[model samples]
Target chain A: MKKFVQVEDVGMRFDTKKGPFVALRDVDLAIEKGEFIALIGHSGCGKSTLLNLIAGLTVPTDGVLICDGREIAGPGPEREVVFQNHSLLPWLTCFENVYLAVERVFGAKEGKPKLKLRTQEALALVGLTHAEQKYPHEISGGMKQRVGIARALSMQPKVLLMDEPFGALDALTRARLQDELMKICDATGATVVMVTHDVDEAVLLSDRIVMMTNGPAATIGEILKVELPRPRNRLELAHDPRYIDYRAAVLSFLYEKQAHHEKQAA
Target chain B: MSAITFEKALEAGAAAAVAEPAVVAVARSEPAASAASTASVASSAVPVARDGGAPSPKPESRAGEWLRAAARATLPPAIGLAVMIGIWYLATLSAGGSLPGPVQTWEAAVKLFADPFYSNGPNDQGIGWNVLSSLQRVGIGFGIAALIGIPLGFLLGRFATLSSMVNPIISLLRPVSPLAWLPIGLLVFKKADPAATWTIFICSIWPMIMNTAQGVTRVPSDYMNVARVLNLSEWKIFTKILFPAVLPYMLTGIRLSIGTAWLVIVAAEMLTGGVGIGFWVWDEWNNLKVEHIIIAIFVIGIVGLLLEQMLIAIAKRFSYE
Candidate 1:
């Protein structure tokens, strides 16, 4: 399969006051079109750093990142990111928040009403049609995150990049949003690169899980393919032997091999 | 408020319901959330949106509760004012009549306000004209300050180099008393009125510039990231993300600037001998009318409080959480 997003030896370094701090070094990953890939790692593992690099929120110190056969230059509407904090402008209503992204992406090609329709449709996709006029402050945490997702999706971006999208949400809201995300991906065929710490979540949602070793200079450790078929049910998977195998594999990589760092810290 | 209460009750019930059954919880929360949104939109605010949407109290005692809340809110300020008056009266008695008592000041205020807009030439105008003239100066000075300062702040906040360049200048000048600028103003303009306005403009500009810069720089990284990912235009970023995010801080700056401007205006007017409350107070002092001076002080205090409150209300409107 042709790679949709190709990261060739991507490296990220921040010049801290003390010295140069390498967050990600020589990280190579190729994501095929329509693939849902999760990057999992321990804390300080730079999973989000890689995702940011992919989103062009940050540039790599070395190596090339190509998206859709073009060099990734800077952040654009083509790669919409659902920020971890659900960074909806607090002043805007949910509909307006979604509309902002929709208008930016589709407004040039479509009329005002069509743009508005897209916003409403995006909100409806997230099961938040009723929350159209509510401000970010007025909504629940999960609802706010949903609006963030809605905003990203409303853009109809080629690549949907999420940075621990459901990390802040409660377990129930997390589960619900995951199901909604799966459905959205199915409907839109969005190529997604999501960062997650949860083993089950990565296993349950992604076509492949790219595990990263702990930083100082974090790099990809291993990539595990999730062979479980789509239209996946969390409950059904809870009892599936294959699901257990995938979940256990990720858990082992994170806890067993990565347990070396935990011991050193201890 | 009723709608807020209902929503609270519904959320509380919904949270408990979630623990038992997901299907039931979803069914319950969906309707409740919609009802809450409508109620909130209709009413403009739902107070119980805070506090984790706690179950509202029983509805029968609402009027009584409101009455109690109102009393609780208003009683302390009333008591404090009364105490202040009592102290003022006692202090006057102790001071051997240098200061007029509250009653004397109140009597003078009543007589003065009776024909407040009267004009017996520019220097001997009514209290209303004096107050209006002072407000006009503040308006002009403050308006110009905002026009210049806000944009400067945005630039300073946007660029580190500009901020660095101006930081020392701002720091050096910011601490100087606004009235001290009166000499430069008078020298430049060769007139009292324009000098007073210049003082106000200079003083008000600092707060607005400092605050706006502070607001712009302090914009959350998340919001900037949103702008980046959206690949919004510079204009769109300013309009959509930057402006709204910095609004609360801008209002703060405006509030502070106005406060300083109002303060500067009175002092400037005193020095300049203008047709304003500050000049009126000085004129009354020249005539040895201590009661009128006291009245002017009260008027200034009241006006400042009103201005602060108005700005506060505006700030509240823009604040999201």
Candidate 2:
């Protein structure tokens, strides 16, 4: 069977003052429907570049990306991106922010009432029902990130692309949000491609962790399939040898094999 | 036991003195009163004995605290005004009564305001009418400027080619004196009122254009990225992402534009020979009514301050964070 999403030998190059800076090269990945995949690497590894390419926020300099049996031409409502900094429009309330997406995606066929209901349901999914009227600035960082997720999910996109969605959050909030994300994915059966630098977050939330080699020309170095059972608890996984092994595999790929010596020197 | 109450009062007094300069005198007297009470209570070794008396003073002190704060807030500006008037009086003395003193200016101001809206003729209206006409001219000129400049600013900001083309011209003309435009205005409009307004328009447009364009350019790319990812239409991008992000900057531009318009109106009115505060000042100077000229200065300063403050209040309301 064909994959739900495909990145075929994709490469991204940015024209900088120095020269054509290659960010990613020969990156190929296939994601099945409802599979939660995490892109893990050090900083400057172009994991976000890969995510952006998939989101169609930026087209790859070479090669093609296909999603849901269509070549990604440009950024569309079908590929929703959850940005790293929780880019909620500060002027908009949390409800309105999510509603902007819902209106765009479903407003043509749906009535205003239906659109409103979808927005409210999306916020409820993220457990932000209490903060529908509050502006992004009025809420905490974690709540803003949740609102960001709500906005992405409100679109009911084919693939949810998150670029370190919980990276800016505190440790406890990150754990809570990770667990919530796992539950959310389980419930909604979302096909997710998340970019994260956190090891535990990858092992806990993802079906497969795509460990990227460090860039000048970064590519997927290793892919680990996480076979941990559903209803996975972090507490149980803390002692689970399988979970530990998956985490260690990712850690070894990131640190031992593809260790960034140039970054350390800098 | 009374010693502790006395010490507490002394500490309170010290804290009060540190917090409020106006309260220093009241705080100083508290210690003396408490010391006298402590001496009287020396024989009675009961702390509860002074508690009732202490609570009475506490209420009094609270009342005095706010009163002192109010005094502190108002006193400096009052003193500054007095010092200014004193210097004016001394200057009159030095000039041997040739210059109008503060009292002379005040009496003139009082008489001038008594029938402020009077109009003897087109050129000889009351100070209030003159001031109003000047403001009206500014409003027309500034309204026109805003109507044109803001949209133009957005266009320039949104398109790089347009900005690069127009920016050089703006940079060249922006530094030219607003008064220089008055002659050009007079030539084109063929009337003093419209000409003065034209000058205000020309003077005000640059700041609005520049600031707004700058604001548009500075809208965080992250918001734009969100816009792109959403695949928002042009109108949606402009309304949802661009407009709110640029509002504060637009307000800043407007504030600056209004300030420039007000400043230019006076000078433009003076040169254009209209019934305006600036013309009234020149007319008073011509009539040797220096006191009225001084009053006009105060009026202009106060009106400018009020205009600035109003815009600031509006800008504050629009600010998102």
Candidate 3:
């Protein structure tokens, strides 16, 4: 069967003031339906660049991205992106923020009441029902990110694209959100492509951890399948040998093989 | 006050007695207490005294605090005004009655305001009519400017090419005095009233256009990204994203434009010779009613202040963060 989402021999080159910057080259991946995938790398590794290409936020210089038998031309409701900064419109309440996405996706067919129900349902899914009337500034950073997640999920996208969704959160908040996300994915059976730097986050949340080498032309260095059984618990996984092995493999690939030389010198 | 302090001292003594049973004996004895009792009392009584003193004085002090705060807010401006009036009085004394003093101006203001809206002829109207007419001209002129300038600003901000083409012309025209446009206004409309309004319009439009454009351009890219990802229609993008985002900037522009409009209306009406506060000022000067001119200055200042404050209040209402 054809892949649910395909990135076949994709390359991305950005035109900068100095010269053409090769961000990624010969990148290839296939994401199956209901799979939670994590793209892990050091900073400036173009993992986000690749995710943007898949979301069609930016176009690739070469190769075609197909989602469910259609070419990825530009951003649409079918593939929703949860930006790193949470990008909730500050003027809008949490409910209104999610409602905007819901209205756009389903407003033509659904009435206002149904749209309202969907918005409430999405916020409820993220356990932010109490904060429905609070604006983005009024809520905590983690809550804002959850609102962003709710907005993406509310659209019922074919693939959910996240660019370090929990990267800005505190360590404890990040862990709690990761577990919540795992539960969310398990409940919804969502096809997710998350870009993350934390090793344990990759091990805890993803079905497959796609390790990326350092740029100027970052590509997939290795892909490790997380064989840890779910419903995964972080406390239990702290001593789980297999979970440790998967994390170590990703760490070795990132640090030993693809160690950032410039960072060490700095 | 001494009674209150004595009461606080008694409360402290009671608290000290509770902390040390030996102090209770010393407290009962009062003035006959020993030096050892006094030393122990000094060490232990301080914190307990503070705790006992705090609660009782709070209710009375809070009322006093509010009065003090009110005085703090009002005193400086009052003093400044008194000093200004005194200077005016001194200046009038030195000028040997050619200029009006604060008292003369106040008396004239009271008399003028007593029959403010009376009108015998178009030129012979009350100060209220004059001020209202000036405000009307500013309103009409500013209204027209807003209707045109705001939309143009959005277009200019949205389209870089249009902005490039228009910005040089705005830069050239904006610096020219509003009165300089009066001849052009006179030439086109062939009437004094509309010409004065035209000057107000020309003077006010620049800030609105410039500020609104700046506001539009400065809208956060994240919001635009949200718009694009949602595939929002242009109308939806405008209403949901652009309009609300640009509102504060637009209000700021309106505030600035109204100030310019008010400023220009005075000068414009002074030249145009019509039923306005500026014309009234000139007419009063011609009739040697210097006190009336002084009143007009205060009126103009007060009206300008009120206009700015109104806009600021509206701007505050729309601000999100």
**Candidate number achieving the greatest DockQ relative to the actual structure:** 2
TM-score-best of 1 and 3: 3
Instruction: Please tell me what DockQ candidate 2 reaches.
Output: 0.81
**The candidate that achieves the highest TM-score relative to the unseen native structure:** 2
Candidate ranking under TM-score, highest first, comes to: 2, 3, 1
Which pairs clash in the backbone of model 2? none
Number of the predicted model whose lDDT against the real structure is largest: 1
Candidate 2 lDDT over A198-241, as tens digits, reads 99999999899998988879899999999999989999899999
Per residue, candidate 3 scores C-alpha lDDT tens digits across A1-266 of: 34899999999999999999999999999999989899998888899999989888899999999999999999989999999999888888899999989999999999999999999999999999999999988989999999999999999998899999999999988988888888989999889999999899999998999988888888998999998888999999999999888888988888888875536535
DockQ pick, better of 1 and 3: 1
- Chain A alone, TM-score per model: 0.98, 0.97, 0.97
Writing each residue's lDDT as its tens digit, candidate 2 over B21-123 gives 5335353634444453445343342333344335675755554555456455644554344334444554564577789876677677789999999988897
Q: After superposition, how far is residue B81 of candidate 1 from its true place, in Å?
A: 2.2
Better of 1 and 2 by TM-score: 2
| Segments in model 1 whose C-alpha atoms lie over 4 Å from true places | B1-70
What is the C-alpha lDDT profile of model 1 across A1-266, one tens digit per residue? 48999999988999999999999888899999999999999989899889988899888998999999999989977898998999999888999888888888888899999999999999999999999999888989999999999999888899999999999989999999999999999999999999999999999999999999988788999999999998999989999999999999999999999989867856
After the best TM-score superposition of candidate 2, give how far the Cα of residue A86 lies from its true spot, in angstroms: 0.8
